[model samples]
Target: MQTTSTYKILVVDDDPDIVELLHYNLTKEGYEVEQAENGKKAIDTAVAFKPDVILMDVMMPVLDGIAACRQLREMPEFRQTHIIFLTARAEEFSEVAAFEAGADDFITKPIKPRALLSRLAAYARRDAQQEGLDEVIEIAGLRIDRTSYAVYKGDEKIILPKKEFELLAFLAAKPNKVFSRDELLNNVWGTDVYVIARTVDVHIRKVREKIGEEYIRTIKGVGYKFNTD
Candidate 1:
């Protein structure tokens, strides 16, 4: 299992106080930490730092967190990196936008240090569990490569954000087996993370958009199943 000391975190926010707070708390918990004041700086710093996780604030000058996350998701190296968005705005749109931009999780601020630490610890545990499962699932014409976090449909390469990719891969691995939203959340996002059932629906929609609707079928009242026939 990977220790907290080995985990690297990048804290991105325009507020100096927030940056300092996160840096202090993260380091105190034994994580290696780096700070970036804005989205552009975050990207540049991430290229060099290669953090395992990024804590990004939603609004900032020179580039917003959503756009930054979109750009980061495009980069092959950052595909597997966990990007969590922090925002003062608890608006539903803000949350939806964050997920659309490829964020792994969303947290509302007046930041609670203890809760945030618990969340980070959950990510570390998930990483350790993932180390043992290296697999590739080829279903129909779609190829889901867990090793590279890449997906290819026949000759076309598709880019799916980390969570979407995991959700798709989990379903594909057990073709024709139906999994409810709660089941998927527990398996893919883990029980420690407090993601809503709707998140699974949103991720499923995004996966289908990238890979085509034929691969995953909705069971209406129950949940979803990867279509093999």
Candidate 2:
């Protein structure tokens, strides 16, 4: 199914063998792969290639994966890129650390080709929706596209998950207006699902990570508002 359609991928690793292996496997799967030996190079390649996903190593020359992810998160070009770490560290602490550092997924070394392919496909499926988003609601330099399932800072796409996309769409659908979490649940997620109102906070956090800390303004004791002011 994936062989006919090609998706661009950036593989960041200091080891030539690992990079080659990823490139080989991904290419075999009909994905176009790019390589970077260090964190800075990874960022450069990401900007230049506009990859659908990034497979990164936690330990690299110059800057590490955590630092690299933070830097990429700051850039508008890569705001929404699906970043997965391919590393040797399999400790529980490392997994938590990866997510805290902005990694969408993590794969341990001694690579399992099938698992890597599956996870990468999942990321691509989400990003494909983002890449096609052109139904834009432009608010100054910011944009929200419901059809594409994408948000952009000027020309740079902001990577967001489906839940976060829906959350932002709901909030932006009525900009500057406060909709309590209960109301949001009723409207956005639909009723009768029995989801926690606290789930809104998790989606909001992910949204903020893509946009900015200040983009969604809290209404103190109520709900959230997309700052129109």
Candidate 3:
């Protein structure tokens, strides 16, 4: 994840060996990293460290990652912070629990360092883009103010998650221009991140629901476009 020092990462796990391994690797990759032995410590360290991402384990001594994730999501400061459950649990139920706890991503244990770095890079890219959006775009009655990171449908404001907002902004940047799934994934999700094309459709659906069904047009056999008419 060769990132700048400005981007911090907090690794939470009860195993000393795992913590050392992750700490050493993340530091070697140029990211400022911190560690917590359990979920309780994870929350404290996260608040003080103000990390950009958190790699947490499902099982810990004091508290579990699922519970920690849920608590962090309730805090406004951690709402957009990317939390990835890096645990050995691979069961379907475990995956469900992780998402239900407000996890942004999940990874099974025994992952290679390079693969882990790739996954984290996707999040860093998305975060950077969200913070960098500076233009205020208005199409028809919909207003996107990048400065405040807010969207307005006429006088009514709409709140969207990081991904949904990014997808909406990308299409609205050039209204009526068609962009294929691959193009959207590359531009919004980052080309380095390997996400399925269907992910775009999911985000598009959410954006349409929040902003209005008439704002985004899905072109069959192609991709999607932002529409004002």
Candidate 4:
């Protein structure tokens, strides 16, 4: 039900020109846009603006994007927010760090406005679909709540970033069914988003780290399945 005009976007970059460029383009697309010059300012702005999507550069004054993302992920309010790293850094380790810090997507920047707009539109569509799902999966002392995006192991609460939570919930929902990396990508990340197969591995490992490794089993030559037993 939410349109592009209703989606709030926070664009963070130390480069004045890049910030201005994105602000101009995003506003022209009908999104409510805000800008921050650095990661510290980004957090302050996000607290006030509460943007649904954040487009942040990796290197910035005071705090870097990875640290800012980690700090944001620690807050319950930003748990479901889409944090996409828009940076020039294309190194594998940088990408890994961004994901570890809870980024939903990573874009290497020459700043392709059209591609960026397409991705944002994909996010909007995904958000609308997710809003219709309100179910809980409880098995093996783990409780996955789609409504509140909360997970619990026994009585202790576990906070998972949006992607990791969705991965876990997807596997658990179909307990004992094996899902290939590609299948998980299409179902969880959606066909509109381009993510590498290894991203699925990264998310699965993070989920296991939080919820315990016992629930999800790697099927040697195949993919992964929830261990109901």
Superior candidate under TM-score, 1 versus 2: 1
C-alpha positional error of residue 29 in candidate 1 after TM-score superposition, expressed in Å: 1.5
| Cα deviation of 51, candidate 4, in Å | 0.8
Question: TM-score for each prediction?
Answer: 0.92, 0.61, 0.75, 0.95
Q: Which ten residues in a row have the lowest lDDT in candidate 1?
A: 126-135
TM-score-sorted candidate list, best first: 4, 1, 3, 2
lDDT of 3 by residue, 89-206 (tens): 8876787677657666668878678888888877776666666665788877878977555799877877665557778888998899999999998888676665456667767876
lDDT of prediction 2:
0.75
Clashing pairs in 3: none
Candidate 2 stretches with Cα past 4 Å from truth are 1-4, 126-229
Model 2 error, position 23 (Å)? 0.9
lDDT for every model? 0.89, 0.75, 0.81, 0.90
Best by TM-score: 4
Give the Å shift of residue 223 in candidate 2: 17
True lDDT of residue 33, candidate 1 = 96
lDDT of 3 at 31: 89
Off by over 4 Å in 4: none
lDDT of 4: 0.90
Over 1-229, each residue of candidate 2 has an lDDT whose tens digit, in order, gives 2332467889999999988888889889888889999999998889889986889999898999989988887775675567788889887677666666666667789887777887665554544444454456777457888766678897688766555776787677678999899988766544523345666776688788778887788898998888878
